[model samples]
Target: MVIATGTLLLALPVASETGQPVKIVDALFTATSATCVTGLITVDTPTTYSLFGEIVIMALIQTGGLGFMTLSTLVALLLGKRITLKERLVMQEALNQLTVEGVVRLSRYVLFFTFLTEGLGALLLGLRFSRDMPPGQAFYFGVFHAVSAFCNAGFSLFSANLMDYRGDLLVNLVITALIILGGLGFSVVADVYTKRSWQRLSLHSKIVIRTTMWLIIIGTLMFLALEYTNSKSLAPLPLGEKVLASYFQAVTPRTAGFNTLNIGDLRPVTLLLIIILMFIGASPGSTGGGIKTSTFTTIAVAVWSIIQGKCDIEIFGRRLPRGTVLKALAVASVSLLLVVTVTGIMLVTEQEEMEIILFEVVSAFGTVGLSAGLTPQLTVAGKLLITATMYSGRVGPLTLAFAIAQRLGRQGIKHYPEEGVIIG
Candidate 1:
């Protein structure tokens, strides 16, 4: 419904720079991308959109990033409406919280933290941008980029998408910080906010922080090493800038698509590394998408446990629930299926090669907007296919599965005897 309204508004003549009506296909695609917090754009945002349209896109990005449920709850609370049990349950599901208790309080924290972070981020960015742009223009750019980065919605006013800022440590650091904060998931942030010590953190929080740190460290090292000789990407830059660029490239694929490096020019090895990072995107309940770091970590631990002949998956001196393991498997399986299915469809319909198409499909599924430059040339049908993929990716596999599980529950609950099947 939000996407549809945004599409309609964007399709208006007032939304376009030339005062000409936007194409329905492009409008729908943009709406979906913005609302899904997927940064893929068919049209150049700054040149093609008016300020009105940009605002709408940003609004969609915020709504989608924090989630509509969170926003609606905010409104409800502001209006002094008592949040009912049903409303709390819906928010619990939306935020992927473990329990029904304190979900409203969590929602409140989510909203408050979102505004505070984005505001501070915008201020820092504005100060840096003012040196180059007029105060108003700089402020505008700052607010937009801050919101985009914080939402992990990679939509940029600049057509090159932060390429010009490759050497600017101020811009790079601020943007990347916003991305990391947003992608860390509200729950994790809140956990840290409430409990500032390492030992006091929940096991889930510990794993997320640890995995995130390792990924950024490893990714930075690998990118700096791999792209050091590639003139088109990192080679021509100064040593300091190269490291900064490498670090930005490493972190952005955790479902934040603000790229300082040219994604297309990277070697196959770097792209594969990025693809793995994108697939194992941000933490759960983050503004970002992908199967999530938790799901990836859970799967890895489960596999390792099997290899070690352990009956239980253990982490941080605690045994994980079996349901968590099952859900992780379900998420990974569904995500892989979606990516494969979309790639197959694009292969049949589009003219792009296998690697490029796979990249695009994974990008859409991961809700990461870093494209290999194939978005502009896709047909209307191809765009529609990607739009659906973006929606599914943003909503997530487990959410859809849970909805189905609810439907199945209504029919009747039944349990059957376990049956053995041959294994590899």
Candidate 2:
């Protein structure tokens, strides 16, 4: 519904650069990108969109970021409407929570913290943006970027996308912090809000925070090491700029989508690393999308347990349910299948290089908008393929699988014995 409305609004003449009706396809693509919080674009946002159109896109980004149900719940709360049991269940599904308990309060926290975070980020960025543009324009730029970064939407009014400010430590750090906070997931945010002690944090929250920190550190180090001598990438930059750009590179690929350097100029190995990061994108119930950090860790821990000859996986001193292990495997399998199928289709329809094809596929499936500058040149079929991939990424492959799968009758009378089927 959000995408559809955005499409309609964007197709109007008021949204276009020349006061002409925009192409439906382009408008639909942009709307999907914004609503999916995917940054893929066929048209440059700042140049093609009027102020009203820009506002519409920002609204879509926020709506998509908070989620439709969350917004609805917030509205109902504001209006003093009693939330029913059914509404609570829907909120659970929307937020990917394990239970309905405290959902209303969580929803409240989600909205409150979201606005508060974005407001503070905007103020910090506005101070920086004011150095370049007029006060009003600077403030608008700050607000747009704050929402975009916090939402992990990656939409930027600048055609160059922070490349001009690549060396600005303040801008780099602020955006990085917003992206990390947004991608860490609301559950973690609320956990920190209600409980300040790491030991008191839930296992899930602890895992998320720890994993996020490790990823950032590892990614930053890997990027710096790999691109240290790449003339088109890091070699030309000053020491400070290179470090900052590398840090930004690490944070952005965790599904934030902003870029301080030329994505196309990165080393092939660096691109492969980004693909891995994109596939493991943001934590559960976060504005960002991917298979999720929890899913990835669950799979990893399960494998390590098997290698250790343990019958069950353990984390943070608690046994992880067997069902969770199965679910993690299911999510990983489905995600791989989706990426493979979409990449195959794109390979057939597009003439881009393998790196471009792979990068775009992972980017779409992860809802990470960073591209190798291939999005604008996509054929109609390629665009449609990517559009579907973005929607799937945001909804999650496992969730989409459940939506399409049919329940089957169980074989009650028959019994089968477990047997070893394969060896590595």
- Whole-model Cα lDDT per candidate? 0.90, 0.90
Per-residue lDDT of 1-424 in model 2, one digit per residue for the tens? Answer: 8889999999999998789887898898899999999888888999999998999999999998999999999899989999999999889878878778999999999999999999999999999999998989999999999999999989999999999999998999999999999999998899997899988999999889888898889999999999999999999989988899999999998897999998998889999999999999999889998888888888999999999999979999999976677777888898999999999888899998978998998998898899998999999998889988998888866475344322222336877897887888
Candidate 2: regions farther than 4 A off? 398-415
Clashes of each: 0, 0
lDDT of 2 at 366: 90
RMSD of 1: 1.9
Model 1 ranges off by over 4 Å: 401-419
Clash pairs detected, candidate 2: none
Candidate 1 lands at a TM-score of: 0.96
The sequence of per-residue lDDT tens digits that candidate 1 reaches over residues 69-88 is 99999899999999999989
Q: Residue 109, candidate 1: how far off, in angstroms?
A: 0.8
